[model samples]
Target chain A: MQYAIIGAGPAGVIAAETLRKTDPQGSIVLIGGEPEPPYSRMAIPYLLIERIPETGTYLRHSPDHFQKQGIEIRQDRVTAMDTPNRRLTLSSGDGLQYDRLLIATGSRPIKLPVPGIDLPGVHNCWTLEDARHILRLAQPGAKVVLIGAGFIGCIILEALAERGVDLSVVEMGDRMVPRMMNQTAGNLIKRWCEAKGIQVHTATRVKGIESRSGPGFLKRVTGVLGLDAESGSANALGVELDNGHRLQADLVISATGVQPNSEFLKGSSVELEQGILVDNRLRTNIPEIFAAGDVAQGRDFSTGGHQVHAIQPTASDHGRVAALNMAGTDTLFQGSFNMNVLDTLGLISSSFGLWMGVEGGDSVEICSPEKYRYLNLEFQEDVMVGATSLGLTQHVGVLRGLIQGRVKLGQWKDRLKRDPSRLMEAYLAQNAVL
Target chain B: MQRSLHIDPEKCTGCLQCEMACSLENEKVFNIAKSRIKVFTFHEEGRFVPYTCTQCDEAWCMHACPVEAIQLNKLTGAKVVNESVCVGCKVCTIACPFGTVNYNEDSGKVIKCDLCGGDPECAKACPTSAIAYIDANWTGLDRMRSWAARTDTSARA
Candidate 1:
C-alpha cells in the first residue's frame, strides 16, 4: 500500500513512522509546506530566546534520517486533493497517488485585520521564518507593541521581555489569557507582567494601524464597509485604539491565535466545521482519507462533540490512532483531552478538561495571589469536570488524572467546596486505584 | 543483535538514584534538575513512571534537527547531539514524545541520554530493576535489514 501524509508536523511525521513500523513494505511520502526540515512551531520561542539556532527548530537532527527510514520527505504544499481518483496536486506541479492519505496540516496564525498590519515591521510569531524576522527587530531596548494577550501572545511577550525590549501589550479583553484563565487568575497574571515592567493596556481595542500615508487603506476599506475611519496620518507607525489612545511602535507582533490549515480541504468532500471532522478512528467522511492534529475536529472529552484540540500531545495521539487504522490495525481514539500547561516567565499555569465550569456545577477558587498561587476547581455532580491552577505544579498531572478518569468525588465534593486544598485527600480517597 | 534499555515502571521506586547517576556520569554533577532521566510522580494513582529517551530505531529527535547535530553513533545505536553543531533550538525537546531531550540553559544546547556510550549509568544505579540495559533488541538488526530486502534500491554492486 502507498501512504501519503500531509503537513509533516508532529501528527504527519508520527503517522509516517507508525505506518513504516506497522507495514514495513508500504511506500510512504511525507509532504510539508515549509522549505525547512520538519520543525516544531512550539520550539520557535527557544529560537527567539537565542537558546537554539535555526537548525534547532528542526523536529529531527540526524541527516538522511528519512531516507534511512525508507520514507520520502517532500517539501511541497498540496494545492488540491482528487479523492475519487486517489490523487493529489502539489504546488510544485507534481501529483501523488496514495492508497491511504493522512491530513495533519496543523494550523496557521490568524492575521490581525488592521491597516498597517501589512507593514514590514508587523509580524505574527508563528513560523520559524516569523521568529527569524522577530529576532531581527526585537532588539534589546527596541520599542515593541504586541497585539493580543492570549496564551500565544503571553508566551511571545515573555520571550520579547527576556530580550530586554521595551514592550507594551494591548488586549481588548479585561485580563490576560482570557480563554485559559478566569478573571482573577487573568488579573493576577496581568499584575505579574506589570510588576515585571511591561506596559499593558486592557479593555482597549485597536481601531486602526496607520502608516504615514494617512490612516493607510483603512480609510478606503472602511469607507466601502460604511464604518467611520480615522481622519489623519502620523509621522511614525501609530496604532489608534477605540479608547482614543495612540501608541508608537517600532515593531508590531500579532499573537492573537491560529486557525486550522484545512483550507485545501475546502471544495473537497471532507466535512468541516472550523476544522475537518474526523471519527474516533481519525477517518474523514471518505474511507481512504483521514485527518489528525490541529487540522482535525475530533471528539472532545468535555463537550463530547467534535472540536479542534490544537495542542502538541493531542496531535501526537491523533497521529498514532490515524496511522494504526491506516495501516490496517484498527485503533480508536478515546477522545481528545483539553489540556494546556503553559510556562509564562517562570509561572507555570495549567488548565484541564472543561476549565470553564459547566452549567449547574459547583466551583471553588483558592486564591493567594500575594504568593503567586491559585487554584480553581469545577465539579459536576460527583466528579471533577475541570480545573485551572497557577504556580502549582504537583496538582497538574493529578487534576488531569481525576478528570480523565472521571473519578467520583462522593462526599469529597462538599469538603472540596469548603477547602479546595483537600484535593490531595480527595484524590487519594476515591481515585487512588493504584 | 543490539542491546537496549527496558524500563518497568512498576518496579520504579522513584528514589532518583538513576537520575543522580545519569547526571554524575555525564554532566559531572549531582543536581536532579540537570539529570537527563526524569521520574514523573502520579500521586493520585500512587505510581511513578521514570521516563528517558527510548533510543527509538528511527529516532524523532535525530530526524527533526535541521542542523544535523543529532547523529547516530553506529556502534551504540544512540543518537548523540553534537553540542558544537547544535544551535540550542529545543526543537528536539518538542519532537520527542517522551520529553527526554532537554535544553541546557548554560550551554544553550539540548541534551539527552547517550547510553553512556554503551555502558549506561542509569541501569547500574537503579536500586530496583526498573531500568535494565539488557541484550534485548528494539526492532532488531534483522527487522531493519528486512526493510532493505523489499527495496529496488540496494548497496552499490
Candidate 2:
C-alpha cells in the first residue's frame, strides 16, 4: 500500500511515522512544501532567541531518520489533487498515485490588508526562512513594531523583547491574547509587558505602512551605484496606526493569525468548510482520504461540534488517529479541546475548553491584579466545563483533566466556587472517588 | 515481560528517599527538586502521595511532542525525553494531564520518569515499598489480594 501525506509539519510527520509503525511494509511519502528539512514552527521563537540553530528546528535530529525508517521525504507542493483517482499533481508537474492520502497541510499566517504590508522590512515570523530574515533585520536597538496581540503575536512579542529591540505591540483587540484570555487576564498581560520596558498599544489597528527615506536609504543608494558599500542596510518603516499615530520601525512583524491552507482543495470533491470537514475517525467525506492538524475540523471537546483547534497538541493527536484509520486499524479520535498555555515575558497564563463561560452557566473568578494572579472557572451544573488562570503554573493541568474527563464535581463544585484555588484538591477527590 | 512502576500511597512515609534516589540516578544530583518523582504533602490530610509519570499506553506527552523528542523505551515501556532533541518548548509539560512532565531551567529540557531504563532507582530506594517495579499486567494484583484477604471468613475467632 502507498500512503501519501501532504505538508511535512507536525501532523504530517507524526502521521507518516505512525503509518510506518502500524504497517511496516507500506510505502510512505511525506511531502513538505518548504525547501528546508521538516521543522517545527513552534521552534521558530527559540530560533529567534538564539536558543537553537536553524538545523535545530528540524522535526527529527538525525538527517537519515526518515530514510532509515524507509519513509520517503519529498520537498514539493501539492498543486492539485484528484480524489476520484486517488492521484495528486505536484507543483513541479509530477504525478503521484496513492492508495491513501492524508492532508495535514496546516495553516499560513494572515497578512493584514494594509498598504506597504509587503515591503522589504515587513515579514511574518511563521517559517524558518522567515526566522532567518527576522534574524538579519531584528538587530539590537532596531525599532520593531509588531502588529497583532493574539497568541502568535504575543509569542513573537516575547522573542522580540529578548533581542533587545525597541518593541511596540499594536493589537486591534481590547487586550493581548484576546481569544485565549478574558479581559481581566488579557489586560494583566499587557501591564506585565509594559512593566518589562515593552510598549503595548491595545484597541489599535495599523492603518498603513509607509517606507521612510533616511540615512539608511542613502547607504542602499551608495551600494547600488557599484560603490564598495553594504547592500540591504535596514531602513525605518513608518507604521501608521488607526489612532493617527505613526511609529518608526526598522522591522514590522505581522502575526495577526493564520488560516487553514486548504486553498488547493478548491475544486476537489473533498469537503471543505473553514477547514476540511472530517468525522470522528478523521476520515474526510471520501473514505480513502483523511485530514488532520489545523486543516482538519474534526471534533471539539467542549461543544461536541466540529471546530478547528489550531494548536500543536491537537495536531499531534489528530495525526496519530488519522494514521491509524488510514492503516485500517479502525481507531476513533476523541475530540480536541481549545487549550493554550502561554509564557509571555516571564508571566504564565493558560486557558482550557470553553474559557469564555457558556451562557446560563455558573462562573467564578478571583482576580489579584497586584499579584498578577487570576483564576476563573466556568461550570455547567456540577462539572467544570472550562477554566482560565494567570500566574498559577503549579498543578494547573488539573483544570484540563476535570474538563476533559468531564468529571462531576458534585459537592466539590460548591467548594471550588468558594475557593477556586482548591483545584488540586477537587481533582484529587474526583479521581479518588472514581 | 513489561514491568511498570506501582505506587502504594498508603505505605509512603514522606521520607523523600525515592525523590533523592531519582535525582541521583538521572541527574547525578542529590537535590529533590531535580527528581522526576515528586512527593506532595497534603498537610490537612496528613498524607504524602508520591507520583510521577505513569508510562501510559497512549502517553499524552509522547504523542503531544512536536519534535518527537519524547520516545518510548522499547525495553522498559517508558517514555524518555531525548534532551539533545528537546527544544524546551514546554508544550509537553502542559500536555500531560498528570503534570508529570516538568521543565528544567538548568538544562532547558523537560524531565520525566524514564523508569531508570527498567531498573528504577526510585522503587529500589523506596523504604516502605511505596514505589515498586511490578508486572505491568498485574499492577492491581496487590490491591486485589488485599481485598480478597479482607473477605476471608475461613479462620476468624
**Considering only chain A, what is the TM-score of each predicted structure?**
0.92, 0.96
DockQ of 2: 0.23
After TM-score superposition, the amount by which residue A46's alpha carbon in candidate 2 deviates from its true location, in angstroms, is 0.7
Q: Which residue pairs does candidate 2 place in steric collision?
A: none
Candidate 2 docking quality: incorrect, acceptable, medium or high: incorrect
lDDT of residue A405 for candidate 2: 71
Q: Report the Cα lDDT for residue A429, model 2.
A: 61
What would the per-residue lDDT of candidate 2 be over residues A86-187, giving only the tens digit for each residue? 899998899999999999999999879998897777899899889988897888999899998898888777788889999999999999999999999999
Off by over 4 Å in 2: A214-235, B15-35, B41-46, B105-107, B118-121, B141-157
TM-score of each: 0.75, 0.91
lDDT of 1 by residue, A142-226 (tens): 7788999987888777789999988989998999888888888888889898998998899988877765445457467557878
